[model samples]
Structure formats: C-alpha cells, structure tokens
Target: MRVAILASGNGTNFEALTKHFQSGDIPGDEVLLFCNHPDAPVMKRAERLGVPHESFTVKECGGKEKYEQRLLKLLKQYKVDIIALAGYLRVVGPTILNEYPDSILNLHPALLPSYPGLNSIQRAFDDYKKGKIKETGVTVHFIDAHLDHGPIIAQKAVPIKADDTEASLESRVHDTEHVLFPAALKKVILERMNKQ
Candidate 1:
C-alpha cells in the first residue's frame, strides 16, 4: 500500500509512522509527507528521513474548493492508498473526503465524541478538573465531512491522575497516539491485503 501523510505541526505522529515504515513493521510505502505550512517540523523530519515531502499553503489558493481540489490532485498523482492526518488543523473539505472516503484516517488527541475540536488536551484536562470525566485517551478514526465524526478504527483510554496537569496528561495521550496510530494502520493494511 502507498501512503501519504498530512500534518500541520511538530509531526511527532509523522515521525512515528516513518519509523514504523523504516523498520519494515508497517506493510506499506510512505510515498510523501504533505503539509500546509512550509515551516512545519514534519517537513524537516521528512527530509531527515529521506521521505519525499510537499507543501501546499491554502493561502495561495483562491478558495477552499480550489485548495482541496489541488490536494486531491496531488493524492491521486501519488496513487496514495491511505492518507493519514497528524496534527492537521484545517477542516478537510468535501473534495478530499469524497475522493478517498474511509481511506483517510485522523489521530485525535482526546477520545472522540468529547473534546472533538481544538484544544482537546486542555479541554479534557479542564473536564477532569471539574470532575466531569474520569478518563481521556486517543482515538484513530476515518475522516468524514463532519469534523471527527467518522467511524472509529481504534481507541485506547489513558487515566487522568489527580496530580496530572494538562502537559502531563497530554504527554500520555501523545504517547498513546503514537502507539495506537501505527497499530491501527497496520491492521487496516493487513485487512486490505487479506481482502485481495
């Protein structure tokens, strides 16, 4: 399977996936790393890992539709079988979703159906502080038109300790995401191959 990664930030998850691929633990090729920000750390990571990287700024595009159209074109050009979003902040428009459907997966820091949007880590911490929730974790799900509403492929809970600060809790969640995302992708890739 050929895979592409889209990220907007530090690309810790991107690095995790790359490591998995390099180790031959994941049964797929990472064809490219695409980012909206040229200065995103993921781009640097990609260079260090010798993975082909590309950047497309939405600011350069005339509209959201055009931006997404270009993105779709790039994905198609690479013949990417799977698309992974790591710390990708922008809402993916319909073009990409309709083009790939369940093929695109996103790693969310907080457990889904709660803290669905930005500041998920901080929000979960706040909820824990209020004694409203007992646990928080990571979720890997297919991307849908509705933000973070896609079918969940996998999720694992991490307990929020009494002494846990937002940073501490986020650290655990990030660790979980790094572990879970690769495992989930490995499953998906194996399942697809089995179907063939």
Candidate 2:
C-alpha cells in the first residue's frame, strides 16, 4: 500500500519504517514524508533516505484549513492508501481525518486508556515512581479526531525498572515503537489488500 508519513521531529519512526520497507519486511509503496515545521530534521532524514518530502509552515499556508487542504492534495497526488503519524505534534483537523478515516494510524509512546496525550512517557514514568503502575509501553492505534484516543491495533509493554529514570524509560518505549509501528502498518496494509 502507498504510505504517507507525517512527522514534525527527528523522524526516527519514519527512518525505521523506511528501513523496514527497504528490507521487504513491510509491504509499502511510494512512501512520502510531510512536516509542518519548515526546519524539522525529518526533512533532512527524508532527503538522506531518498524519500520525497514536503513541508508547510502555518504562516506560509495561511491557516490549518489551507494547510491540510494542501496536504490532502499531495496525498491524492501520490495515491496514498494510508497515513501514518510519527511524532507529529499538531492535531489533525477534520479535513484529513474525514478523508482518510480508519486508514490513518499513529504510534503513541504510552499504552492508551491511561496516558493518552503529550508527555505520555514522562507521565507514565512519574506514575510508576509514585507506585501507581508497574509497566508502560507503546501503542499503535487508528487516529481519530481526538488526540491519542482511537482503537488500538497493537501494544507491547515494557516493565519499569526500580532504577529507571524518565530518559531510560523513554528510550525503551521508543525501541518498542520502532518495532511495533512497522508491524501494525504491515497488518493494516495486508488487511487493506485482502479487502480489495
């Protein structure tokens, strides 16, 4: 399936997905990258990986409506079958979500139904420190209009160590994300292919 990744940060998940697709571990086609920040490092990573990427700033686009319209146009131009959000900070508006619906997927750093928004990893770590929970993990889920509240596709837990700090916990969660996101994408793509 054709996949478009939207990221606004380092794009480690984007890199992982590209490598997985290159190795034929995940069946994908015509992968594209999109970022809202003009200077986001993901743009550079996209360049190095030979993936076509586009960026738009709020001021350049005028507003969210026009920005998402341009994004929709690009998605259509590339015939993207799925939209994967990786570290994208902005909340997707109705324009894209309505257009893609269940085809859009996101990888969250915390197991959902608990820590659901920004700084989830740190929140989970804090909760653990307070003895509120023992483990936290990554979740791959379908993206809805709500932030990080969607049907989960896959999840894998990482136990909190007694000596774990926020950074170490974040590292382990990222490792889980790199693995789980691709697997979830593969499953979503395979299901799409089968239904067609």
Candidate 3:
C-alpha cells in the first residue's frame, strides 16, 4: 500500500519508517513525506531517502479546511492508502480523518490512557521523578479528531529505573517507538490486505 508520513520536527520516526520500508521489513509502496514547517529536517531526510515531499503552512492555505483539502488532494494524487503521523504537531482535522478513517496512525512517546498529549515523555518522566509512576512507554493508535484519544492498536511499556533521568527515559521511549511503530503499521497493513 502507498504510505505517506506527516512530520513537523526532527524526522527520526520518518527516517525509521523509510528505512523499514526500504529494507522490506514492512510492506508499503512509495512514501511521500509532508511537513508543516518548510525548514523542518524531515524534508531533508525525505530528500536523502529519495522520497517525494511537500511542505506547507496552515496559514498559507487560508484555513484548516483549505489546507486539509490540499493535503487530501495530494494524497489522492499519490493514491496513498495509509498515513503515519511521526512527531507531527498539528492536530488532524476531520477532512483527512474522514477520508482515511482508521487508516491514519500516530505514534506517541508515552503509553496512552496515561500521558495523552504533547511533551508526554517529559511529563511521564517528571511524574516518575515525583514517584508518581514507575514506568512509561510508547503507543501506536489510529488518529481521531481528538488529541491522542484514538483507539490504541499497540503499546509497549518500559520500566523507569531509579537512576533514570528524563533524557534517559526519553531515549528508551524513542527506541521503543522505533520498533513499535513499524510493527503496528505492519499489523494495520496485513489487516487491510486481508480485508480486501
């Protein structure tokens, strides 16, 4: 299936997904990268990986509806069947959500139903520092209109060590994310293929 990735910052997850698909670890067709920030590093990564990419600002499109309309148009042009949100900061509107439905997935740093929004890794680490929680991990789920409130497809927890700092915990969580995101996508792909 054709896959598109949306990213806003450092595209480590984007790079991981590209590499996974390149290595035949996951079944997907050409990947197109989309970035909200024109100067985002993800564009560079996409170029390096030889993937098609586009950068746009919501303001430039006049409004969310127009921006989403443009994005939807692009996805349709590529015949994209799946979308991955990797560190993509903007909340997805119904335009794309309705078009893709459960086909769009996002990877969050902390296990969902625990920390559900931005700065999740840092927040979870802070909670651990305060002895409020013992562990945190990553979650992969469908993208809904709600922020990080979609149905979870997969999750893996990582225990926080007493000596773990926020940075260390975050590193481990990122590692978990790299592994889990592709696995989750693979499951989604297999299910879609089976349904067809």
Tens digit per residue, CA lDDT, model 2, 77-178: 989989999999989999999999898999888888788888898899889988999999999999888889888899999999999989999999999999
Clashing pairs in 1: none
Model 1: weakest 10-residue lDDT segment is 56-65
Ranking by lDDT: 1, 2, 3
- Cα lDDT tens digits, model 3, 2-48, are 89999999999999888989989888675689999999988999999
Error of 2 at 128 (Å): 0.8
lDDT of 1 by residue, 23-100 (tens): 999998999999999998889999999999999788798778888999989999999999999888899988888888
| RMSD to true structure for each model, in Å | 0.8, 0.9, 1.0
Q: Give the top-scoring candidate (lDDT).
A: 1
Alpha carbon RMSD to native, model 1: 0.8
Window of ten residues with lowest summed lDDT in model 2: 22-31
Per-prediction TM-score to the true structure, in the order listed: 0.97, 0.97, 0.97
Q: By how many angstroms RMSD does model 2 differ from the true structure?
A: 0.9
lDDT of 1 at 3: 95
Q: What root-mean-square deviation over C-alphas does model 3 reach? A: 1.0
